[model samples]
Target: MEEKVYIQLKKKITVEHNHLIKLDHIAFVTGNVPYLEQVKNIKIYQITEQDKNVSVIDGFHLLDTLMVSYPKLAFDLIGPNQVIIEVKKQERKANIFIILFIWLLLCVGSAMAIMNFHYDVSMQEVHQSLSLYLTGRETEKPLWIQIPYSIGLGVGMILFFNHIFKKRFNEEPSPLEVEMFNYQQDLDQYLIHHENVLLKNKND
Candidate 1:
């Protein structure tokens, strides 16, 4: 089946902030011309996947003043792809008290774990011994070797998990994302198999 084009704004818009006005908010459009005119804020996009047609033009009636008088102009400018309309969305505010409470708990828990581990086995002494064994002589602070190794650890993790740094990291899923996609695919297959088994049992 031919893939139906999908279009959506990169970010959710909020009228209070006028975030839609920013050009960066637009994901991708088939054409450059703004199909819908706006006083300040709006975005256009074209999706590659096939889905149910979602017409945003209906919402344009609300902003009839901003829309072009001639409907032909939209057809000439924007292609057949259904344009996803961006509009102000009502959302709940984050609870700072809850956030602070969780953050405090995590910090305290991590600190206690680290302290307990250090008490059981002195990491500083271990580092000194390892450094002496490797280098023949140990420096006052093992930070010289530890710092670079720690930095390398983070770099290695990024390289392993996310390979493409400069190019699109979103359009192309990461390794973990690919694994998740495969897992979901397998789950769907199992669900279909189970449903078939249930139907066979009913028939019997």
Candidate 2:
């Protein structure tokens, strides 16, 4: 009877840039201890080009490689059919001026957008009308009501985003964060499918 080998693949793996990829880096293998060590360290791929950052590896490719070396073992692979591998690189510090500039631009743009929206909706006139009913006075500017409303608008934005700078009010993800997470998931799926298709075409 053949020894049984079980391999569990990770959905995603991160490896250092410009390094040779081994089976153990992307998966977990269990079987004969001596044979397993050799099986785990089998050179499956190499990251040579600096521009090539992401790879979607097919599970069968790993199976084929293992079969060539340890054909006697009955092998079983578990987990996702395709694995995504990303190159890990050193992080560089961003310039402070650029960060400040972007922050300032967003603040100014958002303020302008709010002002334009209020103008288009005739918000001031509506506020003045409400002031007449509440205060029993006809005034050009309803400082009492408008001031509170303005502060409330800012506060509402902060609450809606669920962030005050880097601090979060609650454990719940904000709308923006949820949207971003969805986008990332969609992008990853696309990369996996497209890369697999390209690899299939190239082999054909």
Q: Model 2, residue 159: what's the lDDT?
A: 90
- Model 1 lDDT tens row, 42-152: 432222122122113222232232244333333222222222323434566879999999999997996688678866887778888889999899667889777896578
Error of 1 at 23 (Å): 42
Candidate 1 local lDDT, residue 47 = 22
For candidate 2, the clash count comes to 0
Please provide, for model 2 over 1-204, each residue's C-alpha lDDT reduced to its tens digit, 9 standing for 90 to 100. Answer: 457878888888888888788888888878755567877888877776742778877888778777878777778998777778887767778999999999999999999999999999999999999999998999899989888899999899999999999899999999999999999889889878866522653588
Worst 10 residues of 2 by lDDT: 193-202
**Candidate 2: residue 133 lDDT (0-100):** 94
In model 2, state the lDDT of residue 167. 97
Residue 46, model 2, lDDT: 78
